[model samples]
Target: MTTFYILVGYLALLMGLGLLSNRFFKGTSADFFVVSRSVGSFLLLMSIFGTTMTGFAIVGSTAKSYTDGVGVYGLMASWSGLMHSAVFFAVGIKLWAVGKRYGYMTQCEYFRDRFESDRLGYVLFPILVLLVIPYLLVGVIAAGKFIQPTTAGLFPEAFPMPNLPNGNPHPLNGGIPPAVGGGVICLIVLFYVFFGGLRGAVWANTFQTIVFMGTGVIAFYMISKNLGGLKAASEAVAASDFGAERLGREGMMSKLQFLSYCFVPLSVGMFPHLFQHWLTAKSAKSFKLTVVAFPLFIMIVWVPCVLIGIWAAGYLGPLDPGQSPNSVLGRMVGQLVHSPVLTGLVGAGVLAAIMSSLDSQFMCLGTMFTNDIVMKKYGADRFTDRQKIWIARGFILFVVGATYLLAIALQDSAHVFDLGVWCFSGFAGLFPLVFASVFWKRVTLPGAYACILSTALAWGYLFYHDILAAKPAGVGDEEMLVFGMMPVAIIIAISTVSLVVVSLLTKKPSEAIIRKFFV
Candidate 1:
């Protein structure tokens, strides 16, 4: 009960802080969407890093590491740490410059202008929304999974879930069910985002990043101490027959799989939320810290979560049949930390990491709909600043409702890591469009269109064949990988070929169009 109250208190404090930040809101659409483009260096870094490292980083990594061994770190964190920073430096800074110059608010706006096609937004807007919803689902699913187990046994009498015929509590029986947990989180995020907009998200992200990271360090320390320190923990894992292979290269991952994972991080280059964050930078110099420190931040969050998951195999032993891999982290925290107060704090930290990213994603979707769809197609001049903000808010509420429904429906679906990879792969497949639009002068509007279409077709086919089909029988990454490689590799290859082949074969853009973007 004390733990539950602590969790509630933490959420209330966050909501208050978020609503209070509206005092600084300039009450314009620009301020709501991009914070008047006045965000400083440190806030920009924290916000970018925080938004990127959502439940996918914490919950997904722990679950994957537990299932695949320590090699999960190399498959994602190592590559992402290096690739994410490189992409930020190479792609983010350039986009920020163009966005500042052109007064662009969304990724589709940049594409529409760069390609000189009003219809491009009509095509790209739906695709971007399609990709972003999965990302949002990952956060919602992970938050429910985290909260469900952490709050278990607290209200067993009131919220009694079905149990086994043998009288034991069901593995999934808990304090709050997925629907309620997801709904509460969505409402909190919506309140802050609705009032404070991007400003609220950035401020909330900065605060949540500190809370999660600081408490993450404490969780790691206490877990290690409980298990007789790092040395003993490693030895126990090494000695356990169940997880001994996790300590070696052969048991972790294959060479091709490891190399293919590198492409997954490329998805960051095309994230709509990330694009919005880049545009919020006060100057190009604001990106310097983000590029340098992102890898370190990845390490800070990933290493502990990965290590904890790896230890869980030895500590908790084997899982029962029909159990969720996502619950491993929360279960471990609950068991390892004997103090109820400590358990609540650790749970709050995990929730912070999950929610920090959700706000940005939800807000970005709203910004895109208002700026790209309503204002661009319908005309911004027709709507006042407050009206525009309301338009965005209304669209965002619709999105929130849709996503919440999906989160509930897919509660028993794929692991967070796999779902996230599928989502990121869709974005990564479209990376060629952005990369060529900036660097390659010959890329035509037709080529961009081809890239979008090809990527979407491939993503849809693979997702249905690999994920949705196999999900019924509990198939996961082990069964989903094609020839020991991920589906992203195939999608990227197809998208790149479509872009290049179509661009060379088609007529080039007019000189003025080329000069506006390229020269």
Candidate 2:
């Protein structure tokens, strides 16, 4: 009964936020689609940060830490948070200035106008769907993990997750079953997301970000108290063989991986949805202010989640019997928290983290597919706003469906971190294009095209051989080539330098084009 009330409370809060934002959601497609291009720094900052820190970070990172200690920490992508902020200085602020100056509504709108090539915009659009769908899948899967069972008994018919009849041992021994949980989350997320668009997403994310951050502080405090405080928890981790052993294995590789994780934000600030948020901001000053304040939130909020991961090393044990370490957070709450009401709150907080990102992801995928891929490319200038909205809805369904299928197929796979890193690798290749778009002149259309195609081809080829295909005999998978973001960046830098040299020597973008866009 208590769990029932908590679930109701969480849903009501979400709906209320959406209703509140409805006032601001009025006006043209520009207004409704991207908050009327008047979002202030605080709101803009909160939305961007809120969207990026998904349940994947919370659950997947903690799970990896539980199994492998700080070594697996490389897999968490924490540096992405910092890189995302740095990107604001690099491109986000400038993007905002240009967007407002030109009255651009979407990334594609800006690109099409700047390049004066609908053909290029059309070509560039399909990648939006490819980039965004995999991310939405991660969000959906994580949300499903929390919601399916958190409200399991609240509405038996609505949330019919299975459990043991005897209650002696749990199903999957208290771990979530992927498919059943994943679907429920997708349904709830799709409902609000389809209607809400970017406005709905921003409002919901703002409120949920509060819940997520607040809960992290509270949970960290409670966990520390239960474990005899932070000093004792540190001692426990240092004393535990599991912590030491896992850290040792990860050793240099773990630190290297953590640094590699920075690639997330490196490419993230370039992501279309992020550009949308920048465009929505009231001014460049607001955008800069928001970026400045963002790292504080990351340091305080996210750092605690990592601490909790380490704390769990001492507080929790090897995955209960056959359970995977990834299930550690949920399993620990169920076993150690003791009070059902507190357990419900903790579970809901985790769900908030998951849903915050899910809404943004769905909206990002929907908008990018509709505006960039469908309307701009195929429909050209002939597409109506209503038609675009419908296309967005369709992409939402397709993206969700693909992710649902992936969740089922990859259920047995333990390395979710690898999947996420691989999914975002393509953007690393697009870095030079984005950089040159803002700061560098003499970046020709041919140069941009070469950079995008080269990065995609190289990364795609390597990803397929290493990740998709079965490894050949006697070949170590580690030696099999994980080119990752750094390699992709090197490829782009080389390509861009060569292109600039060529363009300057030959046919540069006309002075008129340079002043209009690049300058």
Candidate 3:
């Protein structure tokens, strides 16, 4: 199959790029973790923007629009366009400056010093890992979901399906299984990250970012042409049973819920991977272009995805029973694009978006585990720089494998948009702690501890009771509320209240501790 061959070629090119980047690796911990803090304006822009546009932007948005209609765009992308840049300007710049000055490598490292407590790093490490897995899962699962539909018939005998009663071939006649697709993609990401470290991830991200954004435009134009144009497609959907649902934001998503998504975008402020990217900036000025241009990049990728998904809602009608909305993007493209070459390019584009985020996430976790956990726990003075790099590589390998298996296990049940939103909510709920730690001069160690423990405990309870258990009693998620507000909104309140109340009532950090961080 030309599509399969082209897809393989794309994979090989990525591997070559990763190996090539290793040539520049300095073989030191600082260079591996943060590119020796020498990255410039353009690379910083590409990597930061690329890492943010995960499967959530491409696969999640398209699938969500397919189900929730054009309003899906309003939920995350519109808010993210405004909020993400605001966070980058307000929060990212400040973190980068402090991290550069203090020689910090991870968010937990910053916390450990900010509070003058090793116990804080120990407390925050597991929580950070837990939140990151779900977000990483979004990218891995999306890789599998997108690959299957476009690569159908490439392995029909190996992953065969039964024909219809009328003897017609099955819709998924032959496709790469989700498990296999996810595994292969994860392995490829691991290859580059293991060799290039953060530098490799950044370089790979720049290349993949360019590919996905450019091909996104091409796919949009070709698909619109295939559909007889967006205007004609809209008119057709408006005439269908799904018309009102596809065209408006009223039915499935309420005004309160729509507005509450603004809180979710605030999660970007707490992203560990994003923090790592911020520290890679050569100077504070490096962030200027990213803040100004991020919203436009969001528009470029998201507009095409949401528009295509709106068209697919009418074009595909009701999906077959048991089918996930994740299939909508590939199925729509495969059916409409028609050319194998074009189909391959779309597949490559989807994988590029997925992997761009994955590399950064994998690298960040490894860097954190090594810096905050391994070095501090064992003794930074004991190991050479090379050993530290190897330790990071080993941890990255373990996490990647764990995540790949988890993604495969949940492939059938997890919804892309739902999983991503939940992950972001956890990070968003903890944003108050991060914001206060950076800006609020009176924040205390006791207050920071209370904030993290309370927010995490509440987040876990709400996720289980409000979301997972809600289905048993016939309560739909969109209609569900906690005291007349979304669960995430409540989580933020708890985070803020716990920090302020506890800090006032508890012992304050010494003047020395305050002087170290504040000054």
Candidate that beats the other on lDDT, 1 or 2, i.e. the better one: 1
What are the runs in model 2 whose C-alpha is more than 4 Å off? 71-78, 149-181, 245-259, 320-322, 373-417, 472-506
Clashes of each: 0, 0, 1
Instruction: Output the lDDT of residue 427, model 2.
Output: 69
- For 30-75, candidate 2 gives per-residue lDDT tens digits of 6656777778877787788777777755666677666556655434
- Give TM-scores for every candidate, taking all chains together and pairing residue i with residue i: 0.95, 0.86, 0.94
Q: Which stretches of candidate 1 lie above 4 Å from their native place? A: 170-174, 414-418, 470-479
Tens digits of per-residue lDDT, candidate 3, 1-519, equal: 999998999999999988998999988899999999999989999999889887667766888898988887888788888999999998898889889989988999998888888999998889888889888888888788778777777788888989989999887668987898999999999999999999989998999899888878888899898889878878878878875478888776778888877888889899999999999999999999999888898999999999888888888898888787877877777789888887788788879988999999999999999998899989999999999999999999999999998898888774544766678789999899889988887899889988887888788888887556636655554634676566889899898999999999988778887777775
Q: Which pairs, if any, clash in model 3?
A: 153-174
Q: Each candidate: RMSD to true structure?
A: 2.1, 3.9, 2.2
**lDDT string, candidate 1, 1-519, tens digits:** 888888899899878878888999888998999999999999998898889888657766788788888888888888988999998998898899899999999998998889988899888888888888888998888787677777777777767789889988786565788788889999999889988899999999998888888777788888889899999998999999877877766856778888888988999999999999999999999999998888898889889988888898788777898776777777777788778888888788888888998999999999999998889877999999999999999998999999999899888875644667688899999998999988888999889989999999998998888656646555545635667788889899999999999999999888887778754
Model 2: lDDT of residue 157: 51
Whole-model lDDT values for every prediction: 0.86, 0.67, 0.86
Best by TM-score: 1
- How does model 1 fare in lDDT? 0.86
